[model samples]
Target: MEELGISLSFSRPRVSNDNAFAESIFSSIFSVREWVDQFIAWYNTEHRHSGIKYVTPNQRHFGLADDICEIRRSTYEEAKRKHPKRWSRHIKSWQQPEIVKINHPRPIKSVEA
Candidate 1:
């Protein structure tokens, strides 16, 4: 495998070796006509993923996310002011995350002294 340049994947202690994520990304392309054009368009333009605060990719791409978030924040503030009892805790953060990541490294456990 090493000579053939194929990377190996296997479970080790405390390390994830699951290939599901890597494998699932592959789309079957039987030719140009059968390619996933519609899905790709919708996924990028229309789909509002929860990870991105429910904003479409195009909105984030064009730097409109901040304005959108601010609008939502203001709306929430007004709602809170009118109906204080509706929120038991602080309003949700409408700010987009500073960074988005996939397969992010997990915090390492520190051994106690």
Candidate 2:
């Protein structure tokens, strides 16, 4: 690798959750180029990512995240109310986050006297 001026760094073993979704997409039936295009389309327009409150990335991009989240919240609330015993706690949060962080850095605390 060094001879080709390339460096390879591997993430820790058994810690591949971050790459699981990509792996699943790439392992689909489509060919490489076709899969890339298809994956992009699906990811942006169709796929509802849990990390983003189950809305498509395009929805968030177009500023429709809040509206969609509200709808989801209402749906869940109604369902829970209709079947109260089906839920043991409050309805799941469908709130759209103002910011999304990947591998977010930990904040450092300041020491006071």
Best by lDDT: 2
lDDT of 1 at 79: 98
Q: Write the per-residue lDDT of candidate 2 for residues 1-113, one digit (tens) a residue.
A: 55786544365444537576767887774577887998899989999989899888899999999998899899999999899999999988988888887679889999999
Superposition-based RMSD of candidate 2 using all C-alpha atoms, in angstroms: 14.9
* Segments in model 1 whose C-alpha atoms lie over 4 Å from true places: 1-35, 110-113
RMSD of each: 15.3, 14.9
Locate the minimum summed-lDDT window of 10 residues in model 2. 7-16
**TM-score to true structure, per model:** 0.62, 0.58
Pull out the clashing pairs in model 1: none
- In Å, residue 35's CA in model 2 sits off its true spot by 3.4
